[model samples]
Target: MPGNADTLTTIAALKSVSKRYGSVTAVDRLTLEIRRGEILALLGPNGAGKTTSVNLLLGLAGPTDGKAELFGRAPRDVAARRRIGAMLQGAQLGGHARVHEMLALYSGYYLDPLPRMETLRIAGLEGLENRPVVKLSGGQKQRLLFALAICGNPELLFLDEPSAGLDVESRRGLWAAIRRLKEQGRSIVLTTHYLEEADALADRIVVIHCGRVIAQGTPAEIKNTVAQRHIRCVTGLSAVQVKMLPGVTAVNSDGERLDIVATRPEHVLFEMLRLDPALQDLEVTGAKLEEAFLALTDDNREAQAA
Candidate 1:
């Protein structure tokens, strides 16, 4: 479980923050807090205002109403800004510069920057220091961006889809680096479309839809919101019979193997065992993060339509 938001030290916060572009509202009076030493994942589909929320916190855009703060001061304050680092999506450095040169330049911006070799190693770019930015692969470039973000030694880090275009191996490597940063007591705010990334990395997830937060909690808590479970077993029971069982929502069968989806697993399992005492290899699992995400977003759409 994540620490209570009320009791944790808030490194950044949005208080009734609303960002509007004339008639369109990008963020609709949304409030969120990023606490120390936790990875808070901001999840939403395209146009859900995840980017807008991050921009508000980074002071790239002013809110139409309410406030954004960092270290209890206005986000744009120089002293407050120094404590934060960000790797925003679609941002890039000069493609012609060598990796080490770019890092050295960024380091010069901070009074006490991380050593060049240390930044390179942390980003998994140790051997590629002399390579030009344009020559690096997609994953390497992304790692470079990450290195630049942490070079300032900021306490709070914001990563927006940090692994958007990486291959599976690259993505896993990035996850390792993020975990290392977390172990070092640096707080991170991650925004990603990858439900698996959020589920695997975040201490808590904040789901947004149509510019407003629709759900927020630990991974298990969020998954539990949908109230569904999956049960698998090798049994003689037919799919038709399983569907007829109490609390069973859906059922499928592959020869002797039965797959059941239900709102009440215990009730369904009891009824199944009562009918098939020989059932074996029973496996029960809760709703996946992907299912919960789709369900929550779909529910929000229906509510808006109503």
Candidate 2:
């Protein structure tokens, strides 16, 4: 598959891009690319420069140094961005305008827009088109923003926290719509706070911290980076006894329950059964994306603080 490199023919590229305000650097020499027909997740903590990176791609802000490109052209070039669709963090819709009117207004801006009815159908707002925009719920408004973004049949989509403020059902609906877009071969760049969202939708995940790319890989690849297995078991062994097991790294307890954090889960469990002889419930799961995310970001923060 094509990557974020020049030779790889990515749809979007940031070459050593940086945005600085006096002594503060919002984005620091960042370089990444979103390839054609792939969903790439931009993962980061608060103040991790995720929004700054999106703005650079949208040409909403000029970089202090380096370049932001879309299909080998500058981001600000209207012709280059003609195939792009962008939905920023916060969108404002007219209070009194009907949903259909809002769709019509945005559709007019595009050179070749989808039919208003088709747009509403695609956004799952067919019956609600006559309703006022302000009367729509937060999730509905988000769906409307997504509808407008794709009205032009854009080849590239930029979604910043696209599922924010959406309920579980609305979120699932939006996810299905995104999958349909992907099936049509549209490339997507998504920024989401929900780790599961990224895990489910993104073909590749890129984690940024301290304004730089810290980790980049597939969901499984990122999760495996931690190389730690978590084991939850109901055993009669005490905390101190569990700690003495070979390869058991850390162990804690909550009175009647023992919580063991270890590098070798199998060895810990083996020892527990042999010693206690009455281990009841047991379950093993892989390291969560959130755990790896926190660890990766914390490492970057520590390095910066050092």
Candidate 3:
């Protein structure tokens, strides 16, 4: 299959890939590609096939149909696998091993791994190198996994919720390290539930739901697809009355505040104020990536139901 014109090189690709287990279809005819020097975020809710897709790409699970490739070669090929590094969810190292020892062990797998000190620094484990894996905190352990993934100095990296157990500070630190990796021209495939992480780091995002991709685009592009404005204010207007207004799709009330989702905020606001002249603290904001995600996924569910 040909690569996308926007990308300079195709590092990995899934061509009409599908994976199934008996009656369950984990991934359904999913076609995706990872480009060189780009961070592509795969996002979806639980049971949405995100992990299945990643497994297919990494050759941990074979596709029931179609193909998965790395560097234009089969993902299972040793050479192809060597070019890729992964930090899968729930992955763990030997509990008795020291952090540095584990990193050294993983480094030996590749012909040219990153320097041990560099990997330790990037993973925020410089001083903790002597600490045993079991002694590390959840956040520290996550950082070590991240360090191990890059230890091989791979051209492509796969991080499945790398910051899952990290605190705010640790998450930011990991983000910085990822940014540095990107600067060094490593392509990355990131599966994360954090929409903000995708918005902040991904060059492109693929949203899958019910084993199929519902949307794929840059963050702004995906958000623009919904084109809804959020209006919130303290108003006496009832949720039912607000929902009946022109261009209003949904409305929710929390105590004294009314939240309105509208395709045309100006029209909705006009109606809202007419009904409740005492409305105060009016705020209108464009649709966030989270809102767009919900709208797109909900639309797909509705379509499938129909």
Best by TM-score: 3
> TM-score of every model?
0.83, 0.84, 0.88
Worst 10 residues of 1 by lDDT: 1-10
Clash pairs detected, candidate 3: none
- Better candidate by lDDT, 2 or 3: 3
**Ranked candidates (lDDT, high to low):** 3, 1, 2
Tens digits of per-residue lDDT for model 3 on 1-306? Answer: 124453678779999999999999999999998988889999887788999999999999999999999998988999998898999999765578898888889999998999999999888888998999999887888888899899999999999988887888988998999988988878899988767888789989898888898888997775565568989999987889888888887898888888899877988888777888999999998877567668878888888899
| Candidate 1 clash pair list | none
For model 2, how does the per-residue alpha-carbon lDDT over 1-306 read when each residue is reduced to its tens digit?
Answer: 244343245889889999997898999999999888888998877678888999999999899999999877889998877789888898866598998888888787778877888778778888998999889887788888998888878888999989888889888888998888887778889987566888889999888887899888998776555345566777777777778877655666666566666556777778787887888767676666566567667666777789
For residue 247, what is the lDDT in candidate 1?
Answer: 77
lDDT of 1 at 185: 81
- lDDT for 175 in candidate 3 is 90
lDDT of 1 by residue, 115-178 (tens): 8888888889999989999998877888999999998887899998899888999888889989
- In the order shown, what is each candidate's alpha-carbon RMSD? 3.8, 3.7, 3.5
